[model samples]
Target: MDTTPQAYRPETAILDLGDAFYDPVTPANFPETHLRFRNDRAAAEVGLETLGGGEWIEHFGRFEPMPGSLVEPLALRYHGHQFRNYNPEIGDGRGFLFAQLRDTGDRLMDLATKGSGTTPWSRFGDGRLTLKGGMREVLATEMLEALGVPTSRSFSLIETGEQLERNDEPSPTRAAVLVRLSHSHIRIGTFQRLAYDRDADNMARLVGYVLRNLYAEEPGDDAAAQLLDRVVGRTATLAASYMAAGFVHGVLNTDNINVTGESFDYGPWRWAPTWDPAFTAAYFDHAGLYAFGRQPEAIHWNAMQLAVALRTVSEAQPLIDILETFPERYQRAVSEAILWRVGVVPLDSTRDRALVQAIEQGMTQSGIGIDRFFFDAFGGTVPADDAFAAARAALVGYTARKPRDHAYWSGAPCSMLIDEVEAIWSAIDQRNDWAPFHAKIAAIRHMGEALAD
Candidate 1:
């Protein structure tokens, strides 16, 4: 994993573990290659920013292998607990790991695809991704990055110009292909599959691979416990950041919990309209299992599942000890995230707790939109209404972290509320109008720059 970023340090390192973990597959050949989006920001990190439109289409849309990367795409194998029901038959049904490379930060990043084609795991379904779904994912990743959430970057999106029928969205919807850059594709369910098969050798092998490649951990007697601890902390921080950013990862299942702790696979994702904890993203979520407020609980439960799988190779007591630290870690991370969003230097634990309560209570009472609330509190002051008095009092002694003179502060905060999201998509769906979509991306990126430290 060379971190020097010299013309893309491509690697096929995942093959060292052999082909049992994934099946070599081919991508679908679409009738048309219509370019829709390209993320130059993400490409620059991996030294791929110089690709022309033809090269981009040739490599991403046509699925041609990048030189010195994976010779063939690998459809990864794993089983997951979908909505808490154990399903041992699920894996990368529609997508596959296309390539692996090192970025400028010395981190291992993966180039994977969605709606690319079908694979060995494509059970009873067409492995095509809807164009509208791809459009939504691009917007979701862009907005999440702007809001400072750790997430997979949407590197490329191309409309395939195919018509597919489905029950979820409008039938005969247009089709697309999506390429995302992520820290790691390894998930908790990856371990679950290994543990279920009782493949002790591969389990240990996979654990070592993760520890070295993702966690930068030394394979010692305590390596398993060490990796678990790091994962728990990262997951806690991710959950805390989501809460601060007002993100609801509609489907927080075990398979979706990447060991690196970045959020991805935006199916029914939504941002909270206000401070409503009961807001659901996926319409089928009648149980509220992965609602806004319960996200921390859902994340924690996924960590527990990881611990359960690691027990096959490590001591139970050490893993349990690490799991016990989630609550405190989550609380501290939440406080830090809130203070960061509020643009204030943090104080002691007691004051931070009071400030959290005050800000949340004020948000709940005032019904201010989440983005607007944070925007108005840029200098740690909201309206002078009595509902905000407690926040003002708790924020009295703190100093602002950054000056609020950026151009973004001169106007209302850019937001991704559901109606606006639909409007952006409807324009594309009805009239092929992409001006609104591109404009929103530009605004979101501007906001990200303004918020950058």
Candidate 2:
């Protein structure tokens, strides 16, 4: 928690190499490094106006901590059941909170590094991220943010010039460093680590820190209960957003769940082209643990894991009761989101149920284009044959490829209907006619403004 600012110097920045919590750093030996993207606007938002350039060749390959920032050596100890196997030997291996800054909005956020170097938790591997992996994360996170999902933003991408080998993908792979701006880098595993290690005192301190920093509005014993409730609510709402947006967070590990309830750690994630509940993006999810349809369940399970970790200090019954509200909250938020997306305001549960069920059936049967369907529907363009063909093409990529599911379509001539919409959409696709569409949606939204007057 060092508040004193120091002159920015990449060379003089404290490495804190001796901390066993991360992989030991060998001086970054790289041929070249590069800066692919610099989030100048995001950096400026957080009052970080200056940045030092790194050798592009070196960065694409080993990460060296950028000098000139306060290095807050944070060991966020937490436990997580990886794939449901409770493991206590987990912590910030090569990643740690470097510094936190209050942004222009006056909200405190962390500037954390991945692939900075190895720490005690670096069991037996190099602490470098592959260049491709880093790029994917940057793209995935930004897309999630634009889709209105609560997510971490990538601050910067620096190519660490190092030659590393991995079993998957090419050997002697290039490395890069990634910077993420998030509400808090603390995860559920942070709590589990202390709880399983019998470090209740540290767990208490960590919980207090979380409350003070992230859940400041909810404080004390009652506040802590409120914080859990807020987490539950936020988690449910976030899951609903994911569902509405057709996003599947491939990894829903307890350690990946943020205490602040913001979505971070996008890994092997994908957008469900069709509304299938069992759609999962993670290639390694042999058991379909964190699929698109199962996201709410996965979130609830993660929350339960968090509740168990929180039980060390907080009352278990209250936490459990709060966790139980996740399903209802998820259902409500998801229904409301769909109505909003479809340019309609939901009036009752009956309407919501009908719309959602219809959409699901359509997606399951004819395999609708989630984005195109909504956009076309919002534009009042009915689907046509070509549009259905495009949707079928999109569905070909699903893991569970169902080509002839009669129950899905309910005999709706989706192909012809979608093709009709496709014709209208095709005609206007290139025209920058945001004016009309914007006005239409705006009018619908401002119907309230008119009513109030």
Candidate 3:
């Protein structure tokens, strides 16, 4: 084993917030370790590229503390309102924050695990992740990141030799563990937990910690309101990003929502097959509470819950004032995100909004696939078909972001529709073929790079 510490800038910032915020836990023992996936890009971010596959599995899968990193895995404590009902029992049941390191951008990033082990928060169920579940999250995160959503990157996945029973899918399936890299692991539920304990001083301390660490530019005197405002903006953009990408998060519980506004914790997530607003990802979401169209509402409601939690330390009216701006901010963000998706830069907000509305109407009336529409309509151009006539008219004055001579423009649009995701996984499950999965990831990354340029 390489005992030398790499260039990773490890920090115990979250741990410094005190033991009340988390509980140290032990990871479960798996009989075997087979590294399944490793995100090289994410590794480079933290300067961990020198660590080979064996070391990656040892640190991530075996739960061996990274050299010069946190001494013990911390299962973060938090409480969330599940589907709008307050639930004080929820926390990091199956996952824990393994380490914190700074990216090249000097931003704090967390390496959190899933299906690694059981913690005190594990309530009545085994703290294990199904291989299929890990596969789905890897796919979901890659696709979302490619689409430019502020989301967590799936870092490492390793098969843990275990067969676990599940109620949702095939029983006694293979098990695995996953690690995700994200901006922060702190959730709105973290504040709720503090509020539930009525720890006003701790609540105030947390607010200061977040402001100093996450939003270091902001003034500390009114940190609570400022944090809420920034969170609202980021959350609004998140909702709009989902709408533009045609994604339904399936579950938008406060615990699943990160305070830093990066989307993570994929469960039953799906892309809309079409432009239907009521499309849902989870099978049990009978009411479509977190449906494609209702995601903005769900996220805004979660922000409100954060505001409620902040009441333990700050004045309520200031927070409420920020909450009231969610609708306008979301509307603006949706228009901006839509324009970004179509590879067009905004010249006029009014014209862009009209174009967005026209595109939405065109998709709804023409029954075109959402991703296909954006793929075809890149560079502010519209299909010549009658179905897109309205959209074509709306884009008459708009300009493309740049020249559209990329080779990707000539290829079929990359999509993560349910059928495609399943096919990718099926190839691996049936014949141990990982080519399709890797090919899909490459294509997605290509699309992301092209968009970025």
Candidate 4:
């Protein structure tokens, strides 16, 4: 392995925030490190693209702290509402923030691990991650990123030689450790923890830290209100993006909602096959609480929780005012997101909203698959077929962002439907053949590059 000095400028800014926010923890020793997936695109962000597979496995899988980074991992402390019920006991039980580095854009990013070890919050269960879960997350992040969603990038995935017992899936199942590169790991629950304790001083300090790190350009005066307003906008944008992508996050717990507005911690997630508003991703969600259509509501609920937490530092009225803007922000964002995905520049807000509304109605009435609708209607051009006549008429005058002459515009769009994901997993699980999975990832990346322009 070439151990050349890399351009990884490490930072421990989070560690300097306060010891009350996290507990120091050690990573588990995996018996084996079998590199399964490496996100070269994400690696390039942090200047780690030159590292060999062996070197990557040793550093990520083995939990070795990158040089000049944090010497030890930190299990972040946070309390969240799980299913609207407050759970003060929940925290990072099976993962830790391994290191932090500056990306090519000079933005701070954290290299965090999942299924790598145990922490004080582990309670009574083993701190391990199933290999299937890791694979699913990698696919979810890749697909979501390609769809232009602000999301965490799956940086590395390495299989650990272990058989784990679980009731959720067939067990004993294989295990692995995953490292995700994300903008930040701080969550709404992080503030909830301080508010729960009624520690106004620490709450104020946290607000300052977040404002400086996450929103550096914002005015320092009334930072709490400014942060809440920014969070509301970002959260609204996130909900809109999910809806436009036809993604159901399944879990919208406050802890799952990152403070930086970047989506991470993929659990039970799925893309809607059709335009079913009630479609759910988790089997346990019998009530459809976090269903496809209800995601905006769920996110808004989480934002209110954040506002409640911020009350410890600022007045309640300001936070409430910011929270109330969620509906308008979400509506505007949904229109903009749809326009972006359809590969067109919105002529105006009213026209864009009408176009989005028309498309949604058309999809529902015709029972069109979301992916197919987007693929066929690139640049807002509806098909000549009579079935889409209404949709075509709705977008007749819209202009494309660019000429739709790319070869990508001619084929079926890449989809991450459940069946396709299962088939990819089955090939690896049954035949031990990873060719399908690799090929699917390559195709998804190609789609992403094509759409990125």
Candidate 5:
């Protein structure tokens, strides 16, 4: 009987924080509106599954207001270092926070956008996203989520009828816009901006906003330190998960690193084809700064930068002390992550550490396919080597978590290798055949269900 649109209770929490945090902006006018993808599952999480096609496009594509969501989108303000180069001017050039609402779990979720339109931050660049880029992100986020990495969900993708030029990929490419459902859009750069301005008051206010809205907790006297500690630990866990999933987030810039430790802005991301440490994702990253093996260090480096930004609100020594704990925490998180990928229960600290080392050595020396290696070695089995036997010895006292009878465990593992991704895109580009795309999504979700821990 409760058929009201506001039944889900959308809240403009970020707006309440004031306009200093962001700039009010308008969405772009596209020539055509075609709904390329709609995440009904994510919609259901925020109680919007009842929207029909026209309604979906109206809200997400045409930028029409939801019943009780934000009226004007907010282009967020923040500055970040790009490849360690401090760029004090970069913010959400094309994207903005569209709305804020609580999910089924009562956690505040952000409905945000990428390539929606230009903002005051858009300098010397057209505010648009390539359709290929949008599709890539949708696939990337879906696969990452299925692999159990904490990532933002690509909520909806609409192919705006326009052609765009780009340095990468072919020119005159189709353009699109994306809406993401995420925990928080606040990045390390958000604090970096305040620190750069020496705006300690706003820095403190930002910290308070993070604690209350993003974290759903009350702020304290040591809020910055507490937040930094939580962020560091979660970033460690996120780094370990990326390693376990064989993922290489190409751009590990401070702006891309969310304070919530939830990964977003999937651009130029790739799967490690093999176990090589120097495997780079983005084609432009010829120097391999953010490579597969070096991702942990890059993540740690970003976390430290977050710490540096927090220094404006906290003592330098105290923050450095918190940063020092990263190495030990990362070691523990990686051990747990590797064990989870192997689907084995932890026997003890020592045995688990040894098992992790064995797995790493096997990956390095075996030359097995990165995704295939995990699939074959699930449940502490396979690779048929002395090292793996020793790894199994570490697991002798415990049983596996995954059931053997699961249908997904029988055949090949769910994978998003480049070739498969290319094929999926090629279908869309040539014939507009979305069957492969839909099928891949279903398969990845099924694999996730099978591997649920």
Candidate 6:
């Protein structure tokens, strides 16, 4: 395998793969693993080709390089706050950034394989991922992107015919390797290491590198502070988007949060089918700190911790300014997404609030499929008046405090038609009438185009 550079950067901008990210030399071993999901299109987008054939079992999960490929082993270092407390001992653990490519669009992206055998960071544990865990990540990330959530996508999952031991699930479970594409894998822990080492020079160097690589247009002495602010703003925006979609990231660990504001590491994640603020998806979330509703707050708090790590070099006020924008930015993004889902055009604040409140009430009464209801309304294929009686009956049990047949929209005529439509489509969508769902998405896309002009 060739060790070469696809592109060159200023020496200062090169990522430093310290011992923290590297593992001691060990032969990569994987067995009996099969490719589960191969994202060839996404891989091709970044100038990568699949490396499997009839002898795939011989190469996959092994550290062998593909033809015309460069292998640059990287071990990233960063610190994180796990479960709300500072933890200095966290890093890549087992995985490393293997190579990066500049796609046809001239955008730099990484081709990273998790469970590609262990390195110095393995720390006495098998440096591999469970087949089940990798499968869960593949599903979660794919579904999230389809739903418009900004997430890292899995490119490939290869179940190594190797048996692994884990406490959480059945022992001797299968092991697998996963490849994911992302803007950057830098995290809050990345900075925490410098802060902990009190290496102000390396800290500044890392910040400058991040600015040039991650935010190239914004580079300089003042760039570090500006970079932190931008990260805060983008992080806030992402958090709000997560809330709007009713998705819960069970683990808000600092290591799991990407500095680029992309959601990574899908462990124990869930999407709420209804607007239950307290709904939790993580099985181990005994405290419920990161429940669906508290995601924004958790993000803000995580940013605060990251800000603390950055404070060694940056000013406190700018970080505070960025944190302050989180709530407002989140509100705007979430409101727009909600409005679009409900089929309302050219949204106004008053109308949005009215519709949101109405939908919340309706959800309680109708037992409607949450995502389907709004999608169906936009299609304009609502049930006839006569069918509403049956739809109404379907929703009655969902009402916790009020009668399901309370007819909440009896007086609110502006929303009555959409509500009724929601009831009818709720029933149809359950039958997997995806054609209607597809049509609704197309109609919304058309509306978006008209507004853009």
Candidate 2 lDDT by residue in tens digits, 72-109:
44544556888888887777665666655566555667
Runs with alpha carbons beyond 4 Å of true place in candidate 3 = 1-6
Residue 408 miss distance in model 3 (angstroms): 1.5
- Model 3 per-residue lDDT tens digits across residues 404-442: 787888798889999998898789778878899889889
The prediction achieving the highest lDDT against the true structure is: 1
lDDT of each: 0.91, 0.62, 0.89, 0.88, 0.87, 0.62
How does model 3 fare in lDDT?
Answer: 0.89
lDDT of 6 by residue, 184-282 (tens): 788888888788888877777677767767765556566667777778777877786676556788899888888788888876777677667788878
| Lowest-sum lDDT 10-residue window in model 5 | 1-10
- TM-score per prediction, in order, is 0.98, 0.74, 0.97, 0.96, 0.96, 0.75
On TM-score, the candidate that comes out on top is: 1
Q: Which stretches of candidate 4 lie over 4 Å from their true place?
A: 1-6, 384-390
Better of 5 and 6 by lDDT: 5
Error of 3 at 217 (Å): 3.4
Residue 84 in model 1: shift from native, Å? 0.9
Candidate 3: clashing pairs of residues? none
Off by over 4 Å in 2: 1-31, 49-69, 72-75, 346-350, 379-453
In candidate 1, what residue range of length 10 has the lowest lDDT sum?
A: 1-10
